[model samples]
Target chain A: MARKIVLIGPQRLQPTLAATVESLGVAGRIAAVTAGWEEREGEDRELHEHLGGRTTNLEAWTRVEDVMSADGELTGMIRQRADRLRAAHELYRLRLAHALDAARELLKREPQAGFEDLLEAEREAALRAVRVVDASHLERVSAIHAEFGAEAQPARRTSIRKHRAELEAQLKPCELLCIAGGHVVVLLHRLALLDVLGLWGERRPIVAWSAGAMALAERVVLFHDDPPQGAGNAEVYEPGLAAYSGLVPLPHARRRLRLHDGVRVGLMARRFAPDRCVALDALTRVEWDGSAWRGEAGTQQLDRQGHLTEVRS
Target chain B: MSGFVAELEQEARRGHHALEAFLRGRRFPVVDGRSVTFVWRGEADEVLLRHWIHGLPGGLPFHRVPGAGLWFLAIDVPEGSRVEYKIEVARWGERRLMADPLNEHHAADPYGANSVVHAQGYAPPEWIAHDAEARAGELREHAVRSQAYGGERRVQVYLPARFRTTRRYPLLVVHDGEDYLRFAALKTVLDNLIHRLELPSMVVALTQSPNRLEEYADDPRQARFLVDELVPELERAYPLVQKPAARGMMGASFGAVASLSAAWRHQGVFGNLLLQSGSFVFTDIGQHDRGPLFDPVVRFVNAFRRNPGRPAEHIYLSCGVYESLIYYNRSLMPLLSKSGMTVRFSESHDGHNWENWRDRLREGLSWLFPGPLWMVYE
Candidate 1:
């Protein structure tokens, strides 16, 4: 059976997770994941209260560490993946900066021949260059994941098998999975490593908020229009679990995006065109009901035309 | 002779009643130039007006009108001064704070209230009063199920008198909608503003949150419900301008946070924002003594300060100089401006309340929704 997944923005002031669980009628115990907190993962007392004490932490990070201690080759392979990913990100960062600068510069400059069509065509071409760079970076990251998956699973390290078995056992009695927010990359890493997504899809409802919400998207795009240093660009950090597609969850959007600038707002909408961009603030809940997306009253989406509109189910 | 004597007593009683009515009839504390006269009738050996004026201690005591059961006080004050005071009714050596019953206007604080006195050139606009000649807007109530909140909530929509389906109108959404309507006299203000062509004919939707504290605090589900459910319903029911720039969200205190949060999440939906005395409690800055209840608010503000996004195309942020949240709101202004958002900020010599928010509507709404004539003139 297909599972129900709800994504939201940040959950600081108003938490809808507990209410969401009750609404879903999942009265049984929930398997929880808070590996994003890193060292502070055990801090689930407040969360447990919200869930009526029907939650248990999966501790996937601890399991990952155990696996690394047990298996030398797998640990080495993991380190290699991390090093390569860093290098790829560093290289992509430089290219992306140059590509974006060129695009903006082209848009601002007047045509040498004074033909309006020439300027339009060149501007389109410049934008395409940025897309190309983005696409290329994604491909390299995808290849790395595929290679790791192909080699690691067949080897079947003892620690990995033990952890997988233990995870399945812990999840067996739980009727649902609740994901909390912290560090997006760390959360994503733990969830992916433990195969929690695969396990939950088979049975049980999935309710996630904040960073958890970001991890459900097709691609996790890190964006902050106004940063301490200066204007920042939106970058595709990593691929998401793709539990929910064609939806970009922008959490703490008030603190991040430059929605006032039509050029920037429109470009962002166009950059991820065909896919709708939704603001995932607190008390914001969107559920994929096996067909269409349903949401609350104030949930807004960036339309394909680069304008913001209220999202309807 | 005995019957005639009884008739004379009845006549005297009627005359005294008339005199009492006449004295209470006129607008209290009549102002002319710098001299203001306060009048009160019906027994009290000593009636004192306790005011916060410089060089006045224990208030100016009222003198009894000999053989009239009336107490009157006349004092000279500076022109263009607005004063808030309470009447101290002293009887049997006991004093009690009381509002001037004759004065229709009053300033309110969290602790009870006080009578308001506006000197010459310091009064609120006349347009705030309901005019018989003006056509009033109609308010329609609606209740819709929100998947974000997983419950049903009420939405009150205000349509201008000349609302027509043939044309699309801009949308103005307000949080704590009922409080604004009752306390701020929002409906009356809107009617006058629209009638005098101060602002455009707009469709205002006042949304009520089930859990105002929970819903207003940088919550994502609140944004989701606003955008996905409530908006779609509104769009279907009304002829609205289907663009972000034609829409706005407004609120006071936490409601301000909700307004900004909704706009921030869905910038494409709401292009304009009016925030009044927003509770942007930041731990990195000033005192955050609100404890756990404000933890999320602080976290959200901290995160925003770290990266203040330009959510709306035009933002009007107003704060009271006397409010505890003033420092935080002032600090937030720079971050918002730096986001490249066209920000207009103003401060008033007031505190966090509905009146402060009401006073701001004229400026905020006019600027955000300036009609054809204002656009051309300005």
Candidate 2:
């Protein structure tokens, strides 16, 4: 329910945070969440300087670490949730791998003479199977999150309540929320624990980049065409915060994905149809102004034909 | 004979073309699918191909072409295979080994250099080369006082580019560090992989032994020198992540033995290990035939095989299928897996050499300390 959500590319090589903020005419103290940085969450000096020293780190990661250390019951519940999430992800990954492999094999097969239509139908069916698997995984993750929320009732907890109140106080005077990229799952977990999204609901404009952008989508899809270990299949990681919908933000797509392989690009695009699979590379800036999405020049999205097309609207 | 080799022989028989002139413009070790024909043009009474490929003859006699000084040996090498060999030239009843003068590709080791041949599908990994775009890491030399060795041991520490004192990094102690740098191109690999985000920026301590054969062969002093002496010194000097999981050790051949032995002796100190072509020679019922140097190594490996005892949490091991030590490395995989350590084993169609070890670095290092590629999309 945010007023406006600005999604930027990775900040490591080419940081666009300051430029993006200035371009949007946003000023004053900005609230930043670096929970995704994990142990290095406290190291935000560079970010602060980039934002002209008007940034306040929310310290959501530190808060969770502290609360978990002090409250044993909350820690146990979080651990339980994590274990469940891991188990669910493993099961989903197993199914996803097989489904994706089947789809790829079908796509790679040469159609028999005059049987091209039949082969095309079979390929479509295979793609549908992969999409179904992804949907099922997202559904499972949503269930797990809902179950944990119901059981934990984190707002009512003593340790979490104290930290949440402090966070709310710190966020009250902030004009904008800046989220830096790191581990997407970790970022999502921290944001959920503190209910940061719930607190900032429709209050202020937000700017996020990399995993930060991915965490704002409806569904979080983890993709890597080639990894050191494993088959490098893209899998549905979990449900996102749904800050904005209809797009699966793929940061570092140029490096992590085999973009040149039309078959791979086409399958990924088709699998996540309806929701545009946007490739958010360096210096990219995309904005959702409460209604439609607008992108800067060089912004690209995967098309049905397995090619990168410029994002028009 | 291949068409090229046949043409060369025909030209030599015609006596119109000088053999040296014919060989001048052409490359040696001509590869045709899986068949590799190694050609040598020199004067000698007897010539032999000395190679280290397992399941093949140690020395293959090169057939001397009649009425020509050219010698040729053709062997069916599998595609993607990288073989290193030397040509043994015997003159006046004395034989001497030398690298193929005609072959420009060579891989150097601690002893000397050997001519290298890449079959149809083999090429050195792109990551092994120096990428101009990738910022190179800084290598600083340090001398650590070692009580175990009764002398000062020189160690080189590699600090990744854009390193900041404010940030803490993972530590990896590599044995035979100099050789890895010179022969395996470890620095360039580290630099490229780090820049690519395949591996996190790390602090690597490259340790070398003055007497590696004796020390690296599971010597207790070597283990003590590494864990007890070198690690503490490095930790105190550098801003390293003070956790077992963030620390790792790596080495190749006998150096691998050193890495494993150190981690095993000082359990919970290092959480990851990258062992390449480990000389883990051991005997089940009888003495090992690897001679006296392996006596202590055999004893240590035998005992370790019996009780691995969870030395580290994650272990990455790689060996060449063409190495004689491949059997031992393969045998240790099940043991490491059963010990509850997450183990990844990789095998390549290569021999026990530096390039083989170099090629496996990307896989081994990335698995041990994965970069922010998955975490940070940037």
Q: Tell me, what's the RMSD of every candidate? A: 22.5, 3.9
Report per-candidate DockQ.
0.01, 0.40
- Deviation in Å, model 1, residue A140 alpha carbon: 0.2
- For candidate 2, lDDT tens digit of each residue in B163-258? 888779999999999999999999999999998778999999998888899999989999999888998999899999989999999999999999
Q: How does candidate 1 fare on TM-score?
A: 0.45
Per-candidate local distance difference test: 0.77, 0.89
* C-alpha RMSD over true interface residues, model 1: 19.9
Q: For residue B230, what is the lDDT in candidate 1?
A: 88
lDDT accuracy of residue A290 in candidate 1 = 54
User: What does candidate 1's lDDT look like per residue over A1-313, in tens digits?
Assistant: 5677877656546777788888899989999888775556776788888889999899876778777778888888878888888898879888988888777676557677758898878778877888788888888888887787777762266777777788888898999888887667778877887787776654567888777877778887777665322236777777888887777777766545666665666666666766777877667778885556887788877653346677787
Model 1: runs farther than 4 Å from truth? A105-123, A304-306, B1-378
lDDT of 1 by residue, B1-378 (tens): 123223323444567665555544468777767767776665776899887543457577876655667666777656755666788888888887789888888976445677877767676756678976457999999887889889787899999877777668899989989888887888999898776556777999999787889889988988998889888889899999989899998999999999888887776789999999999888866767897768778888887788777788899999866577888889988889899988989887555767768777888887788753211110
Query: lDDT: which candidate is best?
Result: 2
Once all C-alphas are superposed, what RMSD does model 1 give against the true structure?
A: 22.5
| Model 2 chain B: worst 10 consecutive residues (lDDT sum) | B16-25
